[model samples]
Target chain A: MVAVDSHAYASRLRSWHPAEKAGLALATMFIALAAGSSLTEVTIAVLMLVMTVGLAGIPPGFYLRLLALPAVFVLVGAASAGLSVTGPGPGAGADFLVAVSLGNITTGFTAAGLSLATGLLLRSLAAVTCLYFLALTTPMVDVIWLLRRLRVPALLTELLELTYRYIFVLADLASQVRTAQSCRQGYASWSNSCRSLGGLINAVFRKAGWYSRQLAVALAARGYQGQLAVMEAEHGRCPTRAAWLAGLEAGLLVLAWLDRGHYLG
Target chain B: MAETVLLEAREIEFSYPDGTPALGGVSAGIIQGSRVAVLGPNGAGKTTFFLHLNGTLRPRRGEVRLAGERIRYDRAYLRELRRTVGIVFQDPDTQLFSANVAQDVSFGPVNMGLPPAEVREQVRQAMAATGVAHLQDRPTHSLSYGEKKRVALAGVLAMRPRVLICDEPLAFLDPQGQEELIELLEAESRRGTTVVIATHDVNLAYAWADQVLVMAAGKVIGTGRPQEVFQTAGIMQQAGLPTPWILEVYRELERQGWAAGGSPPRRKEELLALIRQAGC
Candidate 1:
């Protein structure tokens, strides 16, 4: 997660307008979902994969590893979808060519089931990839700015920004506490480790309250009003680039429409 | 005439909500454009006294004045007071709220309601002054401790306050970081901003401050030029502070026949020069 955040900050396309990137990703994802063709899903997934890895400068291996995480879930879901139990009552049909029988239970793979599984797997992978493309390229700061531009309430946007900032703060505090505990041989024995773990949790809870008070003092010193008014990140919109992305999405959808088919292999 | 009093507290008394005495009839005047250091041991009310200076904490029995005007507690006047007297707390983690350095530095100027371009310029200038210009784009969490301190200083500096107060500014700093910060504070003083710092390091106070104020048990035990204030052995002991090395060495040299007659040195370089002149 930390690596993904740093990569977004270091992304070569970071200066590009955030709205354009988010818009393009959202449009492609919706198109793939509505089209429902396996080929269209493949195109969306592949397109997002290349953009995230090649364009966004995230390492290809890392991107694939993240993609593989979803693959596990999709595989289990698709496997279940493809399986049908026709308990000895109905014989295998032409569509259900592959069958396995264990005692009275007969499990068979049917054409309709396989197709549904394929569609599910492809659609999910495409959606995950599209979201990853957006997250890996555009920074959370820009996304928050985009939210503000889209008329999100100041309260919600400020909360999003503050929450993102605190995630690292809490993680850093946790590591510090862990380090302190280990230095004192707090984890040397089983009972000691259990006691130390309990103390660490308690300290973190107390520290959260203490740190918030400190933050309040600092904020008051800075003349913080009811709202956190910060400088908005500026990104010039490029008409030609937006047009190009639109063209690419339209072309992919057209090709998917022309190439729709039905087959069980 | 005496230097114009930039900030003053007259017979101030304060106690924590639990009735712990933090200040007891403390009084001190900070002169305009003076590089001053408030020195004492722990629980000497250095922080409590500082809070009163900017009206962050009001005095229970006394009053604080800025340039002969009593500090007002109304929202608009308090905002003006903070704009004139900006403070950078010792802990950078508590002080820095933004995820990025540039945004954090812009917070003060933005609160002042400056134009966008002016805020940008202030942030840029503050980053440059603190030598964090290159790290402007870096995440606040990614910075080293020294870098974070500089970023925090930049955040306060961006406001361009007439008076800059730093509580225990040198705590948790490496020697190099300390030197750089001293130089930065000195430069700020040269720019006509009254720089008030609280510290335990007598050496830093001796070398850098035009005037020194020593506190003990919530009262001003000594206040004068560093040479005069540090020479008072009784005050130093009461305040739980040792005489600075330069002063000690210089006096030792003077006590022996090896030293020639001269003003006491507050810094090592000056002592060394005197030793060289005396053929020691």
Candidate 2:
């Protein structure tokens, strides 16, 4: 999360209009989901990877490392979905290719199940990459700007902005506590490590309570109303670029429709 | 001497919700266009008294008046009072709520209900004034402690308050950051805004402030020109405060008959000049 937050600020495209970036990434992801084809999903994933790593200048290795974080869960889910049980089948009559049999209960990978899992894995991955592109390219402040521009509820936007800012704060506090605990040999053993974690969590919650009071007083001093007013970034208008991105997304949709039945194979 | 008192609290008293006294019959008046420093040790009610001045905290006893009028407790009155007096709290982490620096600075002006263009201009000017214009796009958490402090000041200064109160404004700044903040506040003071800073650094209070208020426990033990108040050993001792460095040096020189001055120097260069003037 920290890496993504920092990288968004340093992105080569950080100065681009946030709405333009959100529109392209979100529209491409939706197309991938709705198209329901491996070609569409694969294309979307490839495009996003290029945008994040190639265009945005995030290191290819770091981008892969980030994607690999969720790959384990996705792969496990796919494997679970692909596995099937057949009632003492002699051949592929039960759609089972490879089987492990214990008496009359056979466990195997069915052709239909395997294809469904494959499709799901590709679809979800493409969706994940689309999100990564957005997260890696646009800072949270700008993202909130886009949401407010879209008229998302004020309460929700403020909550999100505050939560995002405090996540870094708490994470920093947690790390400092961990270091202090380790310096005293508190994490020298498994039992001590558990105890140290409990203490750290307790302190964090306590500090958060105190922090809110301070925040309220400071906000009041500055004449804060309930709504948090953020200034709009002047990226200026770029209709030509918008046209290009819209045309590109439209082309992807057309390609998805043309290759609609390829995944069924 | 003829300057109007911008803010005055007479017999103001307050206690924490836990029943501990935070202020006890504290009274002081801030003259407009004068730089005043509130000096005390920790838990000396400097902050509690500042809150009262800015209408953030109403005195449980006595009254706080602005421009000779008793402050009303109504929302509209308090809001108006806040517009004229802005207090930058000690901790920048608490004061800076927005993730973006420029946006954080815009909070005060936006709350003032200025038009979007004016708010933009205010944000721009505030950031520039505090030397954080380059960091306008930076995230709040990424800032150094000093940068955060400057951003916090910018956040308050954008409101264009007539009187600026900084609670321990020098608490966490580096020597350079402290120097920079003093320069910024001095500039604001030159613009005819009343600047009040609460600090434990007697040297800073002595060098920068024209008037000093000494607080002990929860009461103001003394208030006067820096020369007059620092000369009172009883008041300084009651506050657990030490005399400024230059003043002490000057006293030692005078006692030794090595130096004689028209008045005490406020800065090191002036002290050096004093030595030269004495032919020491």
Candidate 3:
């Protein structure tokens, strides 16, 4: 079975309209901010995450794995809140413990700090989840095409495309260099590692230079004039699927906005 | 009457920017409609010489002339020269860089500013010629090595060049694939496209090339018809190339006193016929 993840999402999303998706994502963020409560933001974040998991066909474990990286920040904040109470030292803290009001009374610094932390966590999670959905569902090509459509200049798009190509080429060359070094037993010692790494870098630079020259020759042979012209597909206007997705996104935005206003209660 | 030369290089010398001398004092000429093979070992400047054909590289000294016109460094003139002489690189991976096969093949014609319809026609014709029409929609990264080589060839053929310079066209092919390539090149030559190949395979040179130019240490050691060139023991030793297999068999037969002839057959079928006639 194909592993459903961010890469798969990106590939499938290549067929989508980037402008509409970007607009919807922007709308979702605005709605999330206007809904200032931690409860509202957390609810929206969870909903968005669930929708992404379902629509992208990604397993829940995929997202759980990503959460491991961000969990470090959460642990630090929670621990600081618990241990760094500014009142008095422990064992001189009997009076402080009796005097402290921990519930949502809103007077004590501890309660205010907890609320602020909760708000910050919810906001971050909501914003990150929304952006993650955007990244997961959008292909890099669609982003480039949308940039072109939005009049982001031709040179930038060309550079981006070439940069993508060169990255893959460099990655392949690095792997090849590593394999060659390993085969030659150059990684057996620290000095050998340093020498091998230096040699690899030199080789990579030389190969890249040679490749650029060859590219120039190939381009000249093909009569290239520095500008890249892409062959776009011949589909008329926006497809029906895009309109449906846009309407769904608008509906979700309105619902989130209303929930933030407490209109349902 | 002597045949007029289509391309000529006189005392050409070249060195890389790092001061590595690639080619030194090389002089050769290709006559119109002749199939020439450049034979050399690795790092012997065969590819560097091929790059000079269409002015991809300029000689530090001497001159390279095509169709009696000296190759210039001017951009417009270089484009015109490239239109006439197409190069197929040794590595198809470097040559075929487009996302799809059709786009890769159409690149040359489109870059030449052909009309859309004409470019499509050129691409179709090239794909048909190279037997890659079915692969037009396939991604270049997904193609097999042989298919990628064919796609690269089609990319060059779309330019409709009068001369096709192939660098090690059979380097990585199996025996059958090599035979297929030899036949394809022979057919292209018959269609009046001057074919110049740089290769390390002596047997391929003997079987396919009308004329062979052997190089050693950045110098042209010998140039003649393939049979005559292979017979020169000193030239073969200098080029670090073995004599052709058919020539070896002819020598063995001669030593055993079973064959008497003016010269041994260079062609494989002719060699078989001669052996049959000699009853061995």
DockQ of 2: 0.79
Per-chain TM-score of candidate 2, chain B: 0.97
Error of 3 at A220 (Å): 3.1
* Deviating ranges (above 4 Å) for candidate 2: A89-92
Candidate 1 lDDT tens digits, B1-280? 5699999999999999999999999888999999999998888999889888878888899899999998988899888998999888988888887787798899999999999999999999999999999997788889988899899999999999999999888899999999999999988888989999999999989988989999988999999999889988999989878889988888788889777666687777778888898893
Q: Could you give the CAPRI-style class of model 3?
A: acceptable
lDDT of 2 by residue, B38-129 (tens): 99889998889998887888788999989999999787887788889999989888888888888889888988889999999988888898
Better DockQ candidate (1, 3): 1
Which 10 consecutive residues of model 1 chain A have the lowest summed lDDT? A88-97
Q: What is the TM-score of chain B in candidate 1?
A: 0.97
RMSD of 1: 2.3
List model 1 lDDT by residue over A18-136, tens digit each. Answer: 99999988998897777757787888889898888888788888888888877988899998988887765555343575878788777877877787788888888889999888888
How would the candidate models be sorted by TM-score, starting from the highest?
2, 1, 3
The per-candidate TM-score of the B chain, in the order shown, comes to: 0.97, 0.97, 0.96
Report the C-alpha lDDT of model 2 over A1-265, residue by residue, as the tens digit. 8889899999998888998999888999999888977998998999899989999998888899999999999999988888887664374358577878877888888888789889989998999999999999999989988888899999999999888888878788889999999999989999999999999999999988888899999888888777787566677668998998999999998999999888932
Top-down lDDT ranking: 2, 1, 3
